[model samples]
Target: MSKLFTPYVIRGLEIKNRIWVSPMCQYSSQEGMPTDWHFVHLGSRAVGGAGLVMVEASAVSPEGRISPDDSGIWTDAQATAFQRITGFIRAQGAVAAIQLAHAGRKASTAVPWKGGATLSTREGGWIPWAPSAIPFTDGDPLPHEMSLDDTRTVIRQFEEAAQRSLAAGFQVIEIHMAHGYLLHEFLSPLSNRRQDEYGGSFENRIRLPLQVARAVRELWPEELPLFVRISASDWKAGGWDVEQSVLLARELSAIGVDLIDCSSGGLVADAKITAGPAYQVPFADKIRREAGIATAAVGIITEPHQAEEILQSQKADAIFMAREFLRDPYWPMHAASALHAEIGWPKQYERARR
Candidate 1:
């Protein structure tokens, strides 16, 4: 079998292939609950032969949502709703995972396709919380600076969410520490300007994120894996950079994080990102080597050979694709054919396999 089709075992869970679906938000939830839309959207990718199917950035609290329609696991009802989708994914021989997220200063905005403007409280928005009260940009609303109590509560919320995710049958739990979300806000000095133990120096900035990761790891079963997505670089001068990411990854590994899902930018609005095919693979490669941890390479990794070469070069343990998966749900099966590797088709779709 090709490296891309090789089974990857992390801890006690074995993922059937290196091709995993990156969580792309559909923004189609109802009051944070997964509807049938989620079931079909996620299940299709599983049927398409992804090794892992991850739910999008789910809010740990209502205010943590990027918009009113973002998926969440803050309630028992939402967890129950996810059961059907997880069952379908597992049945298709794919590992079911969920990305737990808190948007922080990036929250309370309209969905991307809907202009993405900041929504007022009357417009079904709430005040967003962050490490600092800074607005993402000059025109963005100033987020409320989190108090010590708020910080502790948010950590507890992540622990509770992990418990709920376990009950929902997800085998992996990925913490969203990337893309300028709440945790990223704390990690980047440009966004985190607080004067407490949760801010200032690198150690202080990483305090809350570490706490949150430890909390989740504590609740998450040791037999499963815990992943943390991180913006390897803010792509701006004096911001979160690769060196910091290496140190962070090392620290996370010490806390029992299984892998670092490497991506870039999103800490600031105007930072220039020179994105291209496999642009972010270097981050994963560097982290995996220097930090001595497994890493998932994401962003612009589309072609079959491209993914194969990434694994063959040991750049990353797995390839996470978002837009490519959205465009072709069966990219994995297609990749298998292109790479001349054998992969099984769903029994119902066997007739359609060439």
Candidate 2:
């Protein structure tokens, strides 16, 4: 049997299989609330047969949203809305997870279908803020640097978000600390030029994310699992790299983080992504071995054999796919069939199982 389909335990949480649905921004929320689009989008994956179906990067606060339409759990009302979705995922036997994030310098953009440009207030978008006043690219407007008070508020927001997530019945809480978003902007040298405590050295760069993680960990139930998504490589010189990622992973694991979802790039516009099948798998292997922590491999990992090799090589504790799942919601069942792994199909689709 492919180890990729094997059960793995983290803390007290037992994941039925190794396949995970990587959090892909739905960009379909209404005022940070999960719409029916999110329900079907996420529920289908659980029905498709992944062990863990993580929700998209949910903004912890209004300003943390990647776009005006991104999902959120900042309030009890929002949490209540998510309860239905998580309930559905659980019924299908997949662990429900959420990726809590603050977009930082990457916030206030239009949805990709709407041109992905910085949104103006006139067009229903808010200004982006971060650890420093940096623009993501040459064409993007400058973002307001967050004050010390703002930093504290951000941490509180994450705490509240975590509480809400638990209330909504999410089993795994993943702090989104990577991909050139808020937390990553503080970590990457190219974006964070601050001389303050949140910039300059690695300690300063990782401080806020660490605080956020700790806050979330404290709020989260001990029996549940926690994960942190990190851009293992910024894909540029003098920016966040594998060594720094390993260092951060070790620290996170010590603080009860269950997995490091290893993804790369999105630090800056100048980054040249050398995309290929399993391009970012190396980062997962490095972090898992070097840091002695579990890691989730993401990127162009589409095929069953490719996903199997990652587990066989001890690269990642789980296989996560975004685009592949987007293309085929039944990717998990197909992979199970192709790999000859003995995972059963959803009872509703039993007749269609190969």
Candidate 3:
């Protein structure tokens, strides 16, 4: 039997296979609500036979949104919109997951399609917040350093979003702690130059992310899986790296995080990231062995054999394919065919099987 075809169960949730569709921003929401775009985008992955289909980086608050058009779970009305999509994913026999995010210094930007630049109120953006008053872009407006009360509010927002995610029918919740977003800002010393409880030392730097994970564990069900995606390395000195990642993974697993989705870079513009197939896989491998936890490997993983090798080597617990899935939504079905593995296709499309 193909190892990739084998089911992997986490926290009592059984995924039919090891394939996971990584979260990619859709930038298709209006006022923090999901629309048909979301339904079709994520539902197609379910229909394509992926074991798990994770929704895009969903904001936990209005200001946390990367773009004004980003999906959100900050309110019940927003959660209501997601119910339809999660319902469809479940009906199609795939597990539904979401990446709850807060885009700290990177917030208040236009969609990538619209140039992805900082926005002003006159041009339809709001003030952004971060660990420190830093600007993601050279010409972007400097964000306000989050006050103690503001930090407290963000924690509450994440707790509330976790509740909303459960009510919206999500089976897995992944915290978006990667990129140069709010939590990532906290993790990387290059971005966070504070001297308070949330910065300076490694413990202080990782405080917020761990607290968020603990809070989510408190709010999220014990039987359901929880994931924390982190940029394993910021690709720069004096910033977050694999060593720190391993340490954090140990703590997170102790606090009930089922897996660490290992990704890399994106903490700043100056860092040089060497991107290629399975480049980030080593990070996952290190954490899985050193931290003694399951992990998901992502970034430029395309071919079926490439993904298979990742599993056969015991490098990661799962493969998160991004651009490959975009290129072929039915990759899981096609991969099963290519590898001579068994995974059921959608009933409606099974008749067209080659």
Which candidate has the highest lDDT of all?
1
Which structure is stronger by lDDT: 1 or 3? 1
lDDT of 2 by residue, 1-354 (tens): 779789989889888999999999989998899999989999999999999999999999998998999999898889999999999999999999999999998998889998998887788877898777778877777788999899999999999999999899999999998889998888788888888898899999888889989988987888998999999998899889999999999999888888899999998888988989899999999999999998999999889999999899888889889999999998888888889888978887789765
Q: In candidate 1, what are the lDDT values of residues 113-173, reduced to their tens digit?
A: 9999999899889999999989987977789999999999999999999999999999999
TM-score of each: 0.99, 0.98, 0.98
Candidate number with greatest TM-score: 1
Selected candidate, larger TM-score, 1 vs 3 = 1
Q: Report lDDT (Cα) of residue 211, candidate 3.
A: 90
**Model 3, span 35-152: residue lDDT tens:** 9988998999999999999999999999999999999999999999999999999998889999999999889988999999889978989988999988887888889898878878
lDDT of each: 0.96, 0.90, 0.92
Q: What are the clashing pairs of model 3?
A: 104-182
The order by descending TM-score is 1, 3, 2
| TM-score-superior candidate, 1 or 2 | 1
**Model 3: residue 316 alpha-carbon error in angstroms:** 0.1
